[model samples]
Target: MIAEICFTADWLERKRTELGGVDPALLERALHAFALLGHLAESDLEFVFKGGTSLLLHVPVIRRLSIDIDILCAAPAEVLDRSTDGKNRCGQSRPACQVASD
Candidate 1:
């Protein structure tokens, strides 16, 4: 069964008006992003949710809609030190950083 998260077009329109002209399409995408987060929670990967999206979700007063998803891995540094095809500045391989830059 597909769980609902108030992703109706009507709700998007209403929210767009409430936020003083946020795009309904963007609002819908944001709802989909939250749905993805729900799925992520059920997975084995551990992470700490953060950034503007987190603030908008948790803090009612923050009316600005942020489409970005920022998260911190719960894994230890050693666990994160996997070899990668890319390298960051200072010529050190950072998988997470490389992925973000891509």
Candidate 2:
């Protein structure tokens, strides 16, 4: 048999509290990654805030909960070129750097 249950805001807060709070090291790493990405983009191509990272910057509290960084490029081709040359901050391949859009 299956039981149906609904989660409330209070339940979510309890769950978050039980999760032991956010990791300081992880947050530092994420911020470092964002800085590196910004530097790489500035040195190579043009980039603008996009997706979750943009939202996180606007909402400081959200940054504590964010797990990853998101960025948008103005010159995707240039980004690809820099990434292929191993100049990207992430040091990923061009194909890997290619952003997927629907």
User: Highest lDDT: which candidate?
Assistant: 1
lDDT by residue for model 1 (1-102), tens = 124536666777877888788878777767665655554454455778887788876675746776556768856554334312233221231112322421
**Model 1, which residues run further than 4 Å from truth?**
1-5, 74-102
lDDT of 2 by residue, 54-84 (tens): 5765763452455454656566665556643
Please list all clashing residue pairs in model 1, or write none if there are none. Answer: none
Q: Assess the local accuracy of residue 13 in candidate 1 as a C-alpha lDDT between 0 and 100.
A: 81
- The models' CA-based lDDT, in order, is 0.56, 0.48
| Most TM-score-accurate candidate | 1
TM-score for each of the candidates: 0.59, 0.45
Q: Total clashing residue pairs per candidate?
A: 0, 0
Error of 2 at 3 (Å): 51
